[model samples]
Every structure is written in structure tokens, then in C-alpha cells.
Target: MTTTSARRAPSGSVSGRARDFRLYWVAGGVNLLGSQASGLVLPLVALAVSGSPAAAGLVGGLGLTGRLVTAPVAGVLADRLPRKAMMVTALLVAAAAMTVVAGVLAAGAATFGVLAGAAFVQGVAQAGYESAGAGAIRRVLPADDQRALARLEARNHAMQIAGPMIGGSLYQLARWAPFLADVVSYVVAAACVAAIRTDLSPQRAERPSFLADLRTGLRFVWTHPFLRFVTFWAAGVNFVFGALIYHTILVTGRRGDLPVSIGLILAIASVGGLVGALAAPKVLQRVRPVVAIPVASWVTVGLVAALPVARQPWSYGLLFGLVFLLTPMVAIVFQARAITVTPDHLQGRVATVIGTTGEALRVLAPVLAGVLVARYAPGVAALIFALLLAVLAAYATANVRKLRATVPAVEED
Candidate 1:
């Protein structure tokens, strides 16, 4: 295996490599559809079954909790397990969880506890899939193909517009329809993994001691200034973003017969994200990650903060467009940074840590956001969160010295 610096690719090298990336993109797309479907369906289900917006909030919060709780363990397993197998299992488990939720809804026994439990399991499944899938990208393409990776990220953003609209439309017909459809998409995603051409083999076939493996991954993160800074900034931004996810959905969904309204906002936001995601590689080629990331974060921070004060379509629309463009860019740049810094053998663990830490903040943020919204207006919380994000963005940019010089340096063991 090569070293990270050994794989440093010229920016112009990504052309003519579309075929390899397309296969991986297809699988990602399948999962993306399922994710988008579930995103809308889960909240709707909780709202319908529990008859309270708080129940939906709890369910969503628990999912992030599951992700945060499972990430460390999943990180270790990602290094030891076969990537495809891990992803397939994650998809299957998620499918089963959704299936159970669907059945409970069908049976009219979908209590808050049941929804929370299902969400927790689904979150764990998502944790595993994310850790494995991020690592698996190396198996699918060479270093120079990162632009393709950016495109996949873009495609996912695009689906945010398409998937939720479809899911929400379907939800209007049968509340359970979205969940059932989500299950089938998972099945397809699993099959796609099984069909990938890469050899199915774990990198650490002997399975190093779990504690030892975890320590190594953590040590890399701690010792590396770049990872440290990025993780901190990402955690902060993710915390706020997580809150928005819950707040926006809750505010829109519970307001009235506004599923379409929610979908429309999401679709418009997706358009902005789609543009950002698709253009990320090109943007990064011209601008450094340090500059790009802080700009994006600040954009999100400002927009989300104004979410509460903004009266109607005008302010909300502008906020949505601003955050939409910036958020996806944040995600893309983060992936690019991770792909650069992580050693290939530790990709799974690195991914796990990244997902976990971000989600840990996310988990707490939503619960707090909900509580605050319940007490004060959602606007107040949004303002506070936005202000915090502004501080975080400033800190990130000020500390750019720690990460700006850090280029990608990954390799398979």
C-alpha cells in the first residue's frame, strides 16, 4: 500500500475516470434515496402515531444518540470487517428497524418508546454504514478520482430535493408507505454492495485487539493537528445543523397541512446544495479548504440564526438557499479532508470517529434545541445557535494555520 503523500493527486487528474466512480455513485444514490425517504417518513410517522410534535422530536434525537453511541465501536469494526459486508449489514438492519416501525404503525401500536427504540437502532445502523462506506470509497477509486466523489456528494444533495418530495407525496397517501418504500430501497442498496467488483476482504484479517485498534485511531486524530482542528469545527457546525434539521422539520410539519410546504423548502434548499456539491471540487481547486469551509459555515450560521426572525417566504427562502449551498459544501470539504488525512487501513475507524463526534454534538443539539423551542420560541434558539456557529467559524478560520498546510496523506495498510 502507498502512503497518503504518495497518493497526492494533481487537481487536473480527475477527468476520464467517470466509469469507476459511476458504479460507486450508483450504490450511493440508492442509499441516498432511502435516506431521503426515511428523513421525511420518520418524522411524519412519529407525528401521526404519537399525536405530538415532541414525540417526533424524541424519535429524531434518539437516532442521533444511536449514531453517537455506536460510532466508536463501529469504527473499530470498520477496520476489521469487510467494507461491503458491513454496509450490507447496516442496510439490512436499518431495513428491519424500519420494517418493525412500519408494522407497529400498521398495527396501531407505535408508541413513543417503540419509535425511539427503532430510531436508536436505525441510527446505529447508519453509524455502521457511514463508517464502512467512507472507508470503502478507496476500494472503488484511486486518489485522483476525488472529483467523482464530489459529484456523488452532489447527486446526494440533488436527491434531497427529489426524495423528500416523493416521500412526502407518498406519505399523504398512506402514512406507512414511505417506511415500506424505505425498506425496499435498503434491500436494493444491500444488493448493490454485494455486486461491487472489489474483492471482499477485511484489511485487518487477524482482528487486532479492540482497545489497541481504537487507541491507534484516536492517537492519529489527537496527534494530527489537522484532524483536531477540523473535528472541532465540524462538531460545532454539525451541532447547529442537527438542530436546524429537527427545528425546520418540526416547525413546518406541525404548522398545518404543510407537508408540501416542507418539501418545497427542502427542494429549494436542495437546489442550492446541489449547486455547491457539484461545484465543490472546482471550488476547492481554486480555493483552499480552510477558506472554503469557514465561509460555508458562516453562511449556514447566519442563515439558521435568521430562521426565527424571518417572517415569511422572503427571509425563509433566502435563509434556505444560503444554508443549502453552504451545508453541502461543508460536507464535501469534510469528506475531502478526511480522505486526505486518514490512512486507508484506518479509514473505517477514522470515519467512525468523525461520524461519532459530529453526531454526539448533533444528538445533544437537537434535544436542547427542542427543549429551548418548547420554552422560548424556536427563533431564540436559532439565534443563539447561529451566534455560536459564527464564533466557531471564526475560530476555525483563525486556526487555519493548523490545517491549511495539511494536505491529504492516506494509504491502505
Candidate 2:
């Protein structure tokens, strides 16, 4: 493996790349805001129409299912096509879908089926856009921009806070408003992506069959112990975290808490992620992954164990926030490492496989948590999740030291 700096364009002439990246950043933030807004609005719309919480969950599940199904195909296209063009096309498709949905809502003609179908389409577009956008980032920026990557992730966290609030408020005012807003955002994001001057198409000598490309990605991850370990660890942690979040929601709702209060608590927890993202690059500069990964894992274990005791809203929020604070830091380090190690031609496939693996269990976690909460106490569910986290922590503690020693040194820009 070669250093990124060795392959990069002259360091002195970074103004063009910097400008292009800034545009890409703005585009990503806009797209994320729209996606998050739609996420909130879709379920609420379903709940309103069907008058059943279960129906709302089904609508959300359909969206995730769409993403899961499309991810592998999206990964292959992202590697073969021009990333900027793919991103623009995806944004346009999403915008068109949302616009039609908005029109349906405005006319009071939307049913659960219609909404679910639209959500699925939007999800597919979102998956493609994200996969291609990641490839675009790799093409436009120098690989060693760790701080820049951290900042991008931090901005994403900030949008997660703002998007829901804006979406919820808009949904309250009028059902069509949130969808309309998302349509506008998609258009703006498309324009931003189109304006980037860098040619973001993959440089390939020959294209392989789609199935062959997908298998290559899977094989690479399977053969690399570090990639395999991190992917599984990420999946396990995400599963537990998803369950914990659902458990919190169940507990709060059962207590007859106000919806606004629950939203506020969750939003407060996201602030911790925002802070962690800002701190990640500096922290990674000082600490090695071997030390940081295990320490963070054990800390998370302690926090999950303590969750059973915190009953009040503020106390619960604080503890939840603290537990999530480590997430962004660890994610930043892991993503930086993954990008550094992966070949340029395989970036799209590798990123997709890793991302898909991490998210595959998340859709099931909420349902499992709800079942557990209904059958047992919330504390019992928390205990089970804590035990799961503890197992993952132990695995990391045993394996990370060897993995860290084997990692190739990839120099920063």
C-alpha cells in the first residue's frame, strides 16, 4: 500500500479541491436534512392515516427494506458510473417522488399504501445517492484529510438535530409542507453536486459483471481480519444501541410523557454526538485505535449498565448522551482507517458492504426491543443489551491489540 500523499495532487494547489469539497459538503448536508425530515414525516403520516402505531412501524420498515435491497446494486453502480452524475440523478428521482407525495397529501388523497410506496422509492434513491456521494468524496478530496472527514461527520450529526425539529414543526402546520421542503432541498443539493468541477467518474480499465463486483467486495472484507472484526463489532454495537433507544421510547411513552418531552430528550442526546464528532480528529491524533477502541467499549458497557437505575427524564437523557458521545469518535477513527486501507477502485463496494453490514440488524432491533419491553420490564431489556455490549467489548479487548500492530501506516496529507 502507498501513502495517500504520494498519489495526491500537489499540496500547494488545493484551492480547487477545497472549493469542490465545500460544495459537496453543503450538498450532503442539504440531502441529509431532507432525508431526516422525510423519515419523521413518513411515519407520522402513516400513523395519522392508519390510526395504528403498528402500521406506522410497517411504513418505516418498508423504507429500510428498500435501502437494504438496493444497497448492493447501488454499490456496483457507484463504482462504475460517474459519481457526480449518479448523485444528481438520485437527487432528482427522490425529489420527483417526494413532490408527487406532497401533491397527494395536499389533495387529501394519500393512503397508507401510497405513502409506503413513495417512502420505498425515496429510500432507494437515498441509498444510491449516499453510496455515490461517498465515492465522490474520495475522488475530490485528498485521502489524508482526517480533520475534514471528522468535520463532515460532525455536520451530519448537527443536521440530525435540526432536521427532525424542522420536519416535525412543518408536519404539524401542514402535512404537505415537510414533503415540499424536502423536494426543494433535493433540488438544491442536486445543483450543488452538479456545480463541483472535479471529474468524479471512476477510472477503470474494464468493468466486471455486477455480481462479480459485489462478490469481490464481500470477499475482500471476509479475507481481511480487521475489516471483518470492525464490521461485526459495528453491527453488534448498533444492534444494542438501537434496542436501547427503542426501550427508552417505550418506557417514556408508557409513563404518559408528552411527545415534545421525548423529542427534546432524544435531541439532547444527539448533542453529545455533535460534540464527539468535533473532538474525534484531535483524539485520534493522540490515541491509537488499540487503546481507544477497547476503552470506549468498556465505557459504553458501564453506561448501559447504569441505564437501569436512571428513571428521571433528565438523568436518563444525560446518561444516554454520555454513552452516545463516544460513538462519533470511534466511528470517525474507523471510517478514516477503512478509507485509508481500501483501494481507490474498490472504495464504493467496500464502503457499501461495511455500511450495509452495520445497518442490517438495526431494522430488527426496534421490533425486538418492543417485544421485550412488552413481555418484560424496560430494565430487563437494558440488562440484556448491556450483556451483549459487554461481550463485544471483551472481544475487542482481546483482538484489537494484534490488529493494531498489523495495520499499515498511511500518511496524512
Judged by TM-score, which candidate is best?
Answer: 2
Off by over 4 Å in 1: 1-20, 46-57, 103-117, 142-146, 200-206, 244-264, 288-310, 367-386, 401-413
By summed lDDT, the worst window of 10 consecutive residues in model 1 runs over 8-17
TM-score of 2: 0.92
Highest lDDT: give the candidate number: 2
CA displacement after TM-score superposition, residue 299 of candidate 2 (Å): 0.9
Give the Cα error of residue 116 in candidate 2, in Å.
Answer: 1.8
Residues 303-353 of candidate 2 have per-residue lDDT tens digits of 888887886788888888888788777777677666656656567777888
Q: What is the C-alpha lDDT of each candidate?
A: 0.73, 0.81
| Model 2 misplacement above 4 A | 1-12, 142-144, 401-413
Scored against the true structure, residue 224 in model 2 reaches a CA lDDT of 65
Report the C-alpha lDDT of model 1 over 1-413, residue by residue, as the tens digit: 34444243221233323343565677778777877877777876788777999888788878877888788888888878877789899999999998997788778777878888989999899888888887777656656444766788688887776787778787888777888888888888888777776643435434457897888778777667777777777787777766776677776665663666665566677777788777777888898776887777767776777787766644565678778777666666656666666666777777777667776676576686677667777677778777887898788778766644454443232
